[model samples]
Target: MSDALVILGAAGIVIPVFARFRITPVIGFILVGLLVGPYGLGRMVYNHEWLTWVTITDPERLAPFAEFGIVLLLFTIGLELSFNRLWTMRKLVFGLGALELLVISTLLGASLSMLGQYWTGALGLGLALALSSTALVLPIAGTHTPVGRAALSMLLFEDIAIVPIIFILGALAPYADAEGLDGLFDTLWLGAVVVIGMMVIGRFALPRLFAQAAQTKSPELFLAASLLVVIGASLATGVVGLSPIVGALVAGLLIAETEYHSEVEGIMEPFKGLALGIFLITVGMGIDLTMIWANLGTITAAVVGVLLLKAVVTGVLLRLMGARRSTATETGILMASPSETTLIVLAAATDALLIQPGTAQFWQIVTAIGLTITPLLAMLGRNLGRRVEPVPEIEEPESGEPPVIIVGCGRVGRLVAQMLTRHGKPYIAVDSDADMIETCKREGYRAVFGNAARMDALDKLGVDRAPAVILTMDEPVLAQRITRKLRAAYPHLPIIARARDSLHAAELYRAGASTAVPETLESSLQLSEAVLVDLGVPMGPVIASIHEKRDEYRERIREGGALEHKPKLRTSTAESAAVQAG
Candidate 1:
């Protein structure tokens, strides 16, 4: 009950307050954990009833939830990545990522050995610290930017390597002898069989399962199905002595092959984020304030030393792989922290008798602290990235001729751009969809990423000096708002708006649009014209009749202004003239 209350409190209070301050919720959750966990206030009030409600007596109790968070994070990562994109990133994912792990682990292992640690212990720690947090890095930096791509490619390889690393650690166990080697080989064989079995089974099963869930139109059912697949796969792998995360990754990849990945990702986002926060809090709980106070200098030195070494190593490797200096620097800094996986490895090492409990506990604290400040590192890296990276050039046309400013880049917007292009008009299309922008760019269209509603984004598109502003986004309210704002700011600029219906067209006109093209009206006209032409009517008459009917509809729509409670049009001589002008 206390744990649930604390989690709820963090979600309801701490997260919102952080968001209000424009600060990251990542830091807020960590600080909340530090304040409540056993090492902090929980220690002072271990037996209290009311006061204990706010404290976490056992962080380990919440470990499964934290682990679930990582599983969801990986699942979403897979959703964002397609097989085609993954195939293209194979070199980076396999070649560069593999090299980075091998080189860094080897270097760190050698350094530990030189410092008089056992070779086994050194190797264990090296492999552990060599991995960076996919769970942290993915959310902080995302999977879109150059840094994100680099981080993801590397993280994917690390997730895959976890089982092998554990096997090697087992082989290094104190008295395993030949049995350990046999077990390692057996584990590998079993893991391969499980992975293949899953691939075959999931390929046949998942789509049907999700399709049925989707057919039910119950979000609860869909979400249940998603959780079932993730837990089932993770459990299957864990039972075979492989890291459960491997199964999670495989489940994600399998789901990614189906069209339902986006829906699954959307439904699971809140769970993923909350679970991730829980994970971060658990990390904070691991930090013993008393231990740090007693050995402040040592703990601080270890934290700084690990961060600096990892950053330098990662940055240099990225640079060698042809990343821009800024991108490499930023990514390296962002990835400096030891992963949550490092804690897992450290614990396993203790179990395998590869490292002492004291040593494991010390590094676990360090890893926790490292995880705590990862978001901060990401922020610092962004600021440094700007200083190192060159400013992006503007995509505006030459001679300062204000291009046609398109507010949306959907089907209607794309058609508008195509028409403008046919007329040799220089225009720029702005859209909120990255996929739409990507698709447009691939097909040799001029599109830039921005929300039509944002003033800053519009300013970049040169909305003030544009020849005309076209609002082609299907959102009626958004179109009206943009139309009114533009009309108030640029009175002389022509605003062409698309409407859902004639009533919406009238609303747009009153909102100061020069012309409002209602999709409902146009589609009807097109259909009528097509029917007439197919029924043996001459093309000219069919077109003329369609145009006349369109003019009549527009006039009626124009007079049915938004100045009244309902759309009202007065029939007058001037209105009839306007309708007949075509």
Candidate 2:
């Protein structure tokens, strides 16, 4: 079939089916690819010309689409981060990430050598396997969550380390040691030049380019400009012997520095999602189930062994870096699978004669299987993490009054606790940040260091018996997760949630929160009240006006919340009166 038709078919079918099951579309796209891939239906029906449209005949034709998908994914990641945030994470990215890679590679390489593989070949394999799938993990974990940020830092460092690893492999090539060393240095210098050049050009040029596109008031033009920036930067970095993703990431970072980032991001979302699905499909295409079945026992053992080893190593490193136990465990398991870059590194090693072709092929299959099941592993990690680091339950509050439970003890939570104290209300605060909890204690607030999402922590706060639960965390996704869980466990318990905006308030309401307070709405109301009072309006009248407006906005939020929970395309039945009469 035509490429466009196939793409439309995949997107139309995979996304909704997966969403219905509350599963990630990553798994769905991969499944669809497996169904039509060469080793599946494609290999079975080459002789039937009329049935050709049912399968993907030439996977090579779709290769560029998959690569561009990864580029777009990295670009969006860059857009999400500022240089300041990236700077703050330099230690984690370099210190923890570097150590994770080095330790895993050394241990794996040593083990492979002991197993009778040549030392050089083992080392190459070790380096390759040490890497994890950035494309798969990033979307699943997100970069804003504690686990997401940690995984991102490590993945960023891994992407940077890929070029050097490939260079070292080249140096191992027969009779090319000196040339490879010289080439490596040249490539590094060129990479430095490329990064600096892109930053300089992007800083000056991207704004002007986007501004012109904006003046046209055309989405097509804006989209064209965004793609141009992504592809151009990717090509520039590729020419310097670095991965194209690095270039795409740099482009996103530079564009983020401009005021046009939001517009650019909005325009790019559909392309990014579609492209990412294509990449996942390519991963599915690489799987040869026949080979897997032939070596089922060995492959399963290898998958199990590699997963356990990486999870232990990574989880340990995260704990040492001060990550909470659950966060570390979840992040480690999410990162256990080998990466797409592992394939590239293995191929390079084979070309350099450091590993035999058959050996490379065997590991390539491992990497593909790892990629295929990455979503399942993420789910498993999340479940296991919850069980392992269940929250500590507090038997009773010091004040002996039923307390409102606050999930986060940051600035917001502290303020809420202080307000509750002033009103003779007992409260307990929980936070993941140990230092924050300590500061709260020093300031005479009752705060505990724990992940509030854990049920034990909530139980300690007497969530079941508390008059109400207050969610004050600024992390919206985490807040929603907690709210959903709490709502499920305590159907009648009132949940007062703090939302980032009106939209968030609506979402919280859908999650069964009793009241979702939007900060923006409250701030606006406060400002309006102050203005009316300044204009010589009576205090009572000003307060009344503010209350009316607030209620109006809230009613809308309630309506929106009701809409979100309503089933789509609900059918009306005409037999209700007859049934009642019967």
Candidate 3:
């Protein structure tokens, strides 16, 4: 299929850049798509009409793939939403998220209406203004700062709000010029109906479905069930006059409390990645460089306006919510990019006939422009982050000794600490997790309670004297943030981070980590080999051969650097295992 070929071509370009640049592959995909799209260099070879024709490129047919990207992406987000985590920031996630959506929406709407734009367009723009790029934010979250996670939580909250926003946009369609309480209530009712119906169905069917799937004990079957839950629930929501993505999100929420949650997520991970890849390429294909150039003033105005508003709002909210000054500012700057959700709102407006083609296209051009400048913005964030005041130093009490400060007392961190302890190495453990710190204390390990990325925590852990800071947070993004902070503050303190995967490891390296260990994969491979040997395969030669190939592969990967091999993850051993098990 031409659609498949397009995606492949885009991936071919993006994969290399992702490996070398430490940039999000989604950005690369978009760039590739733009170059090959009708609005850019591709227009020289094929016109828009040809690209859209079902007999030719069939662009419309890929809409569902784009839609799937949204649904699964949201679904993946929902899986991270636990009651405990929500309660940790009930005030922020609920209050701040709500305030952000309401305040920003109102301001943008009013601004657009004052500019002589139609109320429908104003409403669409209002919703669009509230969104930040999840794709962009995720890679940053991999940086591992408390600010990054806090920013991410806020973005997640915004994502959740998009469901209602879409409904509101749909209601605006029938009476294009009207703004009334009745219309608002009508949209709310539709949203309520969809939510209620899903809650009922999900509460009843999801458990039973997952329970049945578990009996099969086949990862393929589990994956099938996961995809069904996402696509089926999303489609069902679409039938009820809501965005299918919202439906999938609700579905994920419904199953969030279930025992099968982890299993479902594991099965869906690869599909989510592939779907995301396709979506990025599709988004890239839509970028109109000529239009962006022609309307530079308007596009620049829109981008600057949105970024400034979001930055101010986020900074004020975080400060008000008791976050540190550095955290407040970083959170704001890090989340200012317009991403897929913004465009999704714009596209939905077009579908509802709420915005004219020209207006919709205008917003699209602005969005693409914003996306185009995101990498530069990220570089700014990284550069600015290094300038933050360093933590005050203390003399090294243990001179010339290899000191390790394990930031998290979680499973991984504790294990790393214990390993060092067994080797008679001096180390200290710090954790924000109260229970973890208490457990470590009871176990006779030197531990303290404080946010590891916080200056106070680093000082408490004696970071200035530490020769190596071992950050083993459960979250990779959190680890990356700490790594970056440590690099900036304690330049000589070597940071050895634990990455969730190779992609994550590379990001950590970019964040200035001296070393990274993919513990999960390392353990998983060894375990899998053991299992294979138990199942009657010759383990000795097979594993040795596999290790030899793996070494060659990693050597090549290192030669290519981080950006080059980023998109070709499919060709890696990790991807092979995915095919075998997932």
Which candidate leads the pack in TM-score? 1
Positional deviation of 308 in candidate 2, in angstroms? Answer: 1.6
Better of 1 and 2 by TM-score: 1
Model 3 misplacement above 4 A: 46-58, 87-89, 110-123, 142-145, 163-197, 200-204, 347-356, 398-582
Clashing pairs in 1: none
What are the runs in model 2 whose C-alpha is more than 4 Å off? 398-418, 426-582
The model with the greater lDDT, 1 or 3, is: 1
Candidate 1 deviant stretches above 4 angstroms? 82-85, 215-218, 392-491, 496-507, 516-582
For candidate 1, the clash count comes to: 0
lDDT of 1 by residue, 16-76 (tens): 8999997888888888889889888888784666778789989889999999999888877
What shift in Å separates residue 197 of candidate 2 from its native position after superposition? 1.3
Alpha-carbon deviation at 305 in model 1, angstroms:
2.4
Error of 1 at 357 (Å): 2.3
Give each prediction's root-mean-square deviation over alpha carbons.
6.7, 11.2, 13.4
* Candidate 1 local lDDT, residue 556: 70
Q: What is the C-alpha local distance difference test score of each model?
A: 0.85, 0.85, 0.71
RMSD of 3: 13.4
Count of clashing residue pairs in every prediction: 0, 1, 14
Worst 10 residues of 3 by lDDT: 563-572
